[model samples]
Every structure is written in C-alpha cells, then in structure tokens.
Target: MDNNSILLIDPTFDPASASTCNLLVKVGLDSFSYAIINKETKQVNAVFDEQECDNGAQKFAERLKTDSYLKLPYQEVKFAIHTANTIAIPNDLYNEANLESHSQFFTESHSGNLYCQAQNHFGFTTIFTLLRAIDKTLEEFTYAKKYEQNAGLIQLAEKLDGYNLLLDFTVASFNVLFIKNQQVVFQQCYEIENTEEFNYYILLIINQLNINLQETALNLTGIINKGDEKYHCLLKYFSKADFISVDTDLNQEVLDDMPAHYYSSLLALNQCV
Candidate 1:
C-alpha cells in the first residue's frame, strides 16, 4: 500500500452481497462518507470515508468509475444532505411548491439558485434544500432528504412521553431534533468548536422550547464516545442523557479507529431509502 494514499478503509471488511445493494452517501459541507449495504439483510457490506476532499462531486463521479460496486446492476443511491438546513412544519400549512416563502424562517436566507422540497413524516413535513457539493453529473439517481433518515429515530423517541432530544454529530457538523409530547418541535444543525459551545446550544434549545430540564430526555449518536468530553458535558446537565442504540453486525476490528455511534444518521438511511 502507498503510504501517501488518501483512501481509508478496513481491509478485514469484505462487503459482498449476491442480492441487490443500496448505497448511502452523506454529502456534508465539509465531510463526505458512504456505505454500501445488502438490500435484503440490511447488513453493511462496506464503509468508506473520502479522506477530506473539497471537490466531492468530482470525487463522487470518479469513485463510481473505479469502485466495483457502482457497476453492479439494480444498485440504488441515496444522498443525505447536511449542508442544507432543515425545518419541520405542520403539513397543513406547508406548501411543497412554494418553499421559498418559508425561507424567512430558515437560519439561511433563500437565494435565487436555491431549490427546496418537502417530504412527509408522521404527519409533519420536513422541508429542506439540496446542497450542490456533488456535481450535477450524478443527479440521475433519486436524492432523499436527510430528515427522512432521522424520521424513524424521531418516531422511535416519540413512543415515550416528555421531551426527547436526538443529537446526531459528524466530523464537524451536529444536528438537533427535539420531540415534545410525541411531536417534532424543532430540528436544526449547529457548527461547533468546543464542548462549551455545544452546551450553549443545547441550553438555548431547552429554554426556547420551554422544556423542563429535569424531565427532558437526551438520546445522542454520531461521532461521540462514552468517556469523551462531549458526552460528559451533556451528562452534567441531563443526568439521564444516553446514546441511542444502533442495530449493526459490523466487525469491531473494522471500526478500530473510528467512532461507531457517530454514523447513526447515515446508517439510518438504510431504512430511509
């Protein structure tokens, strides 16, 4: 192997499935990662990280040409867009075709080039715009919303009572999905530099939503470890805060140097697609 190679992979993993396969690519603003899974067993065949590339669209196309899986027939592709901010609204009031009007409430202002689409989840509509990180050449495949990937988890959290917070973090991005009384109340992503800033945002959401700190439940996933400062910080305020469970048959050796939990949203796309 070349010491200067940029590819990071687990040599022990042999992602081969005789049946049809699905590809989930998380096209984030700063990070790009993908996984291929068996459509029937839902087991991850392979996981790849594009080792910090700025030109994702170009890399996406080039990789397809070289990656053996891309040539497989009946292979489906799903892209989870994190660069585009997300918001959940009551379906009755949301208009999919007139999304630009709702931009006034988005953390980002709407631009002429921005396009939006809405998907329904448990009676609520998740409206989000797509990020252009990937080149238009690969637009042939259908792109699913990142919020769709979180729908199953959010609904799972709703099965219980009180306030539930789902925090999904990546290499540089973090997403917050708040559920109160079994209803999605808030969903947004935050960019953080440290634990203190992360704490600040959590508190801000709690206060803004008027959630009782003593009764709120926090379920975390993505890029966080049990003993890490990021994990402990949440524990300080919410003593009952815990990481959400993921269903995987992944070999631990393959994830030796990576945080297995951090890929929750991406893995959840298996159900989303």
Candidate 2:
C-alpha cells in the first residue's frame, strides 16, 4: 500500500467472484478511491481510498499497473472524476451543437473533452470537462462509463427531503450541494486550506442562499469526521449537522473499524446509473 492509502477487503471476498462484480473508481487531482461490489447482492467486497495525491492521473495509471484487484474482470466499470469544470443545464436548454457556449457557465476556463450525462429525473443534463490525460488513462478499462463527481451526490440527494445541504470533502477541498423541496438550489466545489477558510465558505453560503441553518438539514460525507474542526465549525451554525447515512444495503463488515459515513458518497457511486 502507498502512503495515505487505505485498503479494506472483506474476508469472504473471492477473486473468482469478481466476474459478477462492478468496479467503481472515483479519482481527482488530490484523491483516488475504488470499490468492488457484488452485482447480485450489492455487497461491497473491497474498498481503497488514497488522499492528498499530487497527480491523480499518474496515480490512477500506476494503480492500473500494480493493483491486483483492478486487474480482475468485472461485469461493469464506472468512473467518477472530481472536477470543478462542470455545469448542469436544463434538459430543454441543452444542445449538443452549442455545447461550446455552455463553457461560459464554468467558474474557470477549461480545455478538455466535454462529456454529458442526462439526469432526466432532475430535468437537466450535467456537462463536464475531462482532461485528455485522465480520459486517455481511463481507456485501460473495457466499456467503462465515466461521470463527474456530482453524479453520486446528486443520486444521494434524490433520496432526501426538505431543505438539505450535502457536503462531500476531500483533503483540501469540499463540494457543497444545496437542495430545497427536492430540487437542486446550488452546487459548487471550493478549495480550503484551514478551518477559517472553511468557516468563510459556510458564512458565504448562508448569506448567499439566505439559508435558515436552524431549520435546514446538514448532511456530511467523505473525509470529514466527528470532533474535527470542520465538523465543529459546521455545528456552530447548523445544529442539525450529522453524517450522511448509507442508504444502500452494502456489506458493512467490509468497512471494518472505519466510519461508514466517511465513504458514504464513494459507496453511493454504485447507485449512479
């Protein structure tokens, strides 16, 4: 195992059964994670998460060459890449011919291949940019489906009700999605260095959205934990803050002594069809 990496395999996991499993990989500039799940039972056989990486593409490529789990044949391979260069356009307003025009909505300029996912349930299509290197590296998998990071979070949000704030954290960045009455109100990823910066964003989000912290539910997932400064900071404003629960019937034993909420968003990748 590499530094900052954690791998957990269920005692009952059998390599021979991989042919009936699905491989889900979530990679970004700073982190990489993957889960092997039984297609029939939806049991997570294994999970691997590595954070604070310098070059995600290079790290993924190296894992393809070294990780034995990745070599096993699986029923399906799905990838969720983390990137801020993503925009969700209403289904009626989306036009493949005018995709270039949509880049204006991006917070930062990006030069990469555009990929779109039709989120018909939400009446919108998610358009995101994928770096050429990352796209090329993903070619190692056969018939792999690619998606942006928000796909899983969006799927998870669909199950929630009322005013909800979903936060998914990485080592130095966090993604926030606000949902009101089952519709997405705001979603964005922010880079933060310390607790103060994290607090700044919380305040900004509250003022920008006129959020009623007392009434709204704050659900957290990924990298964050109880008693952490970030968690405490969130509690200061939102007393309803709590870790998001895993809604799927996954094998909890696979997580062993780890907190299930820490990987709830990652595990939700299995639900992103």
TM-scores of the models, in the order given: 0.74, 0.93
Score residue 202 of candidate 1 by CA lDDT: 76
lDDT of 1 by residue, 1-273 (tens): 122123344453344542366777765544556776666655566666653345444556667667765545436666665545556667898876787676677666544334433434446666655445443544555443333334435544544576788887754557788777777777777777788888898788778888777878888876677887888887777877676655555333444466656566666666652
Clash number for candidate 2: 0
**Which sections of candidate 1 miss by over 4 Å?**
1-19, 50-74, 96-121, 132-137, 140-161, 247-260
- lDDT of candidate model 2 versus the reference: 0.85
Kindly provide the TM-score of model 1 when superposed on the true structure, using C-alpha atoms: 0.74
Alpha-carbon deviation at 190 in model 2, angstroms: 1.7
Q: Write one digit per residue (lDDT tens) for candidate 2, span 131-232.
A: 777877777775888888877788888888899999999888888999998778898877888999999999999999999987799999889888899999
Q: Tell how far residue 163 is off in model 2, in angstroms.
A: 0.7
RMSD of 1: 4.5
